[model samples]
Target: MIRSFAVAAIMAAIMAAIAAPVAAGPIEDAIAGSWRKPADKARDQYRHPAQTLKFLGVKPGQTVVEVSPGGGWYTEILAPAMKGNGKYVAGLANPLASVNAAKSVENFKTKYADKAIYGDIGIGTFGKGVADIVEPGSADVVLTFRNVHNWHMSGWDQEAFNAFFKALKPGGTLGVVEHRLPEGRPDADMKKSGYMKVSYVKMLAEKAGFKLAGSSEVNANPKDTKDYADGVWTLPPTFAKGDVDRAKFAAIGESDRMTLKFVKPK
Candidate 1:
């Protein structure tokens, strides 16, 4: 009877081992998954989605909000990463407010329709002093990518920062990735250049009640002189100059960007 019990225990252990789920691979696997478009995948070398997300402390099962997904560049990766286990809120510009914004919303819906990987994403409208789009104090993480310059230009940076502050839980995080201007560049110069001063961004967030958590150089490109003729748009992707020095800019890759992480103090 003792020998029989030992054999049964061994069998149970083998079955348990077989039933266990496989350990997950690195986050890069999710970014490189088959669901991504080839063009979007190509940009990963510069964007560093895996490293960036890791820095933001994004984990499965957290509630994340992305402000102004704008063609869903990050959405392409975020939607899938959050599928099944987490929540993703997309705070968009009100479509009725702008023809371009209307098109952006339509494109986003069309692209993800019937695609289970996107899961059930929440949609909200933000901008122009309007903050009702996202539920206040409900988000675990709020992220914006290269978008602060637009708000700065529109004279709504403070309002937008305040909205972000309201949207996050007390302990939640705000992650920003924006084109970085050289230190001491005046705010007036930033209006048209699409590059923002790091100090200025931190000031705006601090003014809205957030504390600077940390900053990362993961996305920095020292090759960018921050003095492009057409500003950051002169870099690869946009190449605003249109082949004026395509090879030169392409060699430099994307603009140097600041990756900042801020938190709503608990």
Candidate 2:
């Protein structure tokens, strides 16, 4: 009995020792400082800047890729955050909406003007008909925000997920943020409303051979009805229908979104 207890104690001590330092890395500090400037206006509807990235487990020196980086909101932050010791790549869709795509590239370029610090990071475009843009097992992290639902609507969700999985190195991370619908909801409702069921996200990740790491509520918005007359976009963020009723839209704010973290198993 004494020998058995001693063996177990030593194993526990080793495990704790191994995990202690990684828990205190500079990644947390970088994430904490992601958005230190103006906090309102166009940036208000975004997911909690620092907290969301931290939950996604972004490290300073890792190769990270953001897909369909529209307008470069997150791209502006990501490039600087991964500067010096890391690589940042934005994989955009080929032939993006003319105005939006051009603006995205321009904004990203302007954000990382100091090449010495940010390294050689540029926007990579993949054609629309192709499924994945990333090289198999090349990146340490693959991220996307509000892009999966559109993939689902376009019947390319499976291909997209597969590409994401292939792009990550073994044990790499995939961070996702999407408008959320409640779990177990019927497909009909999901089809009409842009919000997606969490179960579907989990299932897709699993199908792509990823293990669900965890999830977060950093982006949750309680006022979301998830049943807007014009769908999720009817809420504050997009408010597609302008001049309809500003106050009602203002009250709803942004749609509740599921923030997920998945790991490509080694």
Q: Compose the digit string of candidate 1's lDDT tens values, residues 52-112.
A: 9999998778888999888788887787778787887899878888898898888778887
| Superposition error at 36 for model 1 (Å) | 1.2
TM-score against truth, every candidate: 0.88, 0.77
Question: Which candidate achieves the best TM-score against the true structure?
Answer: 1
Off by over 4 Å in 1: 1-27
Q: Give the TM-score of candidate 2.
A: 0.77
Could you tally the backbone clashes for each prediction? 0, 0
Model 2: CA > 4 A from native:
1-46, 95-119, 126-132
> Candidate 2 lDDT (Cα, whole model)?
0.78
- Each prediction's Cα lDDT score? 0.88, 0.78
Clashes of 1: 0
